[model samples]
Target chain A: MAKTVTQEFTKGLWEEIAPFRLVLGLCPVLGVTTTMENGIGMGLATTFVLVCSNILVSILRKFIPAKVRIACFIVIIATFVTVVELLMQAFAYPLFLKLGVFIPLIVVNCLVLGRAEAFAFKNKLIPSVADGLGMGVGFTLSLGALGAVREILGTGMFLGMSVFGASYEPFAFMVQAPGAFVCLGLMLCGMNIIGSK
Target chain B: MTELIKMVVVLVLLSSSSGGLLHWLKTQTSSKIEDQQVKFVKGPALKSIFEGSSNDPTADRFTLKVGETEKNFFVGKFDGKTNCVAFEGFGKGGYGGDIGLMIGVDIDNGSVLGAAVTTHSETPGLGAKAKEDPSFVSQLKGLSIESPILVTNDGGKINAMSGATITSRAVCNAANDAGKIYKEIKSQLTEKVKSF
Candidate 1:
């Protein structure tokens, strides 16, 4: 039992990591990972929503009827997303501006709703929360790595600070939409090779 | 019948409580949210334009209702006199969406103290240059708000930003729109400074 509980949490970190492994929540994973700060901001925001929704969904799992459960879960998830939105606007306004549309779009992130239906509904609160945290951290790290790669190559800057010296010309293509796919694909390939052994 | 009633009870209880909680949270945070909005996003533009003000315009602000929406006005105490105020209004930019502009006007003279593009969705490296090239926006400074604001391409006083005539036009249109609002509400807005 103890081993299984830890596995549930650790599995989300690597074995079933989102975007790269499970291929979930690609909208944000592709859209906002243009900058390192934006990636971390978006990842943390989604994680907050995911963890909160997972915990609430688990707690209500027994009481909610199986038929109307999806609707109930949506309401729960949206409530938390709204809380995040308001809090972001209040305190973290600059990051909120950079991540304008993606924040509210968390309600439909599939990852949040998916966890509610897939894992949290079937599990107890502690494991549900742990799964959420692990998955969220995994997603955060993945996005951060992607954003750093894109920012460095595309803008020739890391976190807005110039890299490779002033003489080097940035391959601006890495910041555009097509660059996102190529970068993500390469990263996935690297992850696959590393994980195989 | 019992199952149907149970469904109704569960949904009603959950939704009503969620609504109540959200409403309370909004009330608790709306003030802070508005303050931060002005400070983080809007303050720099207002401060940059209203530089001579003795009072921080972001802090000395009032809201005026236009239709159902409330518009924020920032007061500037230029030379210790509070006759200047700033506000952001929208103009349709290169795209179909609204372009936000922060405009400062001398209520006494009706001349633009300064203007800046606070937010926009125009094409980067072109239309986005309107915000980057300070000279493009500086052209509007000291122009009488009574005259129409427009890019020279459309037979106006302002020069069009090189490759971004559309965005340039949008900024002019936004400034003109803000000017009209300032004209109509100038009396009410000036009254706000009386207590200051």
Candidate 2:
């Protein structure tokens, strides 16, 4: 089947959904999803890096020698990550502080590298951009959902505002590491259920 | 050998181009980035400590060369005199490595006006509570850090934050260090405040 450019973009929303279907890039997924804000911030940052790296990698694929391709990819990816890091630090210092080490850690995210190697290196520019945006948005949505669920359960709030009422005690486990794993597991299970239908 | 040389050239070209691009971006945003650091990261702590001063401390800030590198000093003016300063201090936390806390010192009295955690990476609910609990930060506000500040666990006056002894100790120790640094550079700081 000849895949349309739209397919490249939309598949990542669910079919090739990351941290679920693809099961890639779980580090930030589990670590930074303590708040809806953190989750969304991380998602957007990843998307920025992914989109730029994908487009750059696709443009330079022909010029790049296969022998040193991975190294080349790393350099390009690292540059964009640094740019994001600096911009975030200057303009979004509060979010930057909240996200902490995870911002720089985006450089090593498997999803970014995987796209660079598997798709961008072989695709045309428009499709590569679409794939980056689609995948990045998908990743952001998943992480944001994880954060929203965790924050609501853990703190009885969404984005730090009271949600479940004063009488309801927050289920603290949702914000902890154990909560992250369990929540991710249940989410993946739910995704499986939907996929089968 | 020829192929290897070409590969080296490829790597070099890619690295140089990326490096150049980053260098340019950094130059464009460096000032704004510095402005954000003051406005957000360290601003709250500075405001909390230097509250009600006649002059804006952040705007009246300066840098002093200490040890090897330069350290920033945010000055608060009272009655047109720069009398207070705030700067970042580092402490070793239990889990997430270095903890950064902003320390505000009264230049004349040599007392810590107040403190706020600018950055930390300890366990979220436990060690992180150190930052959340205002009392923990307030405890250091009026103390004379002439001697090393110790938590109750180490047999001193300050109460260690519940369930976060190591993080508590780290912050106290860092605050104590800030005091010592303040004492060490009192004369030099006084001279710099004149410029501010």
For all candidates, the clash counts are 0, 0
User: Worst ten-residue run, lDDT, model 2 chain A?
Assistant: A156-165
Where in model 2 is the C-alpha error above 4 Å? B79-81, B89-101, B109-112, B116-176
Against the true structure, what is each candidate's TM-score?
0.93, 0.86
In the range B1-196, model 2's lDDT, one tens digit per residue, is: 9879988998999999889999999999998888888888678778877888887777778888777878888988777877678888888655688778888877777777888887888898999987777678888877776667888878888898878888988898688767777777889997887677
Residue A119 of candidate 2: its Cα lDDT?
96
lDDT computed for candidate 2: 0.88
DockQ for candidate 2 = 0.74
Point to the candidate with the largest DockQ.
1
Cα lDDT, model 1, residue B5: 85
Model 1: residues with Cα > 4 Å off, grouped in runs:
B66-68, B153-155
Write candidate 1's Cα lDDT for B99-141 as tens digits.
Answer: 8889888878888899888888788788888777778888989
TM-score of 1: 0.93
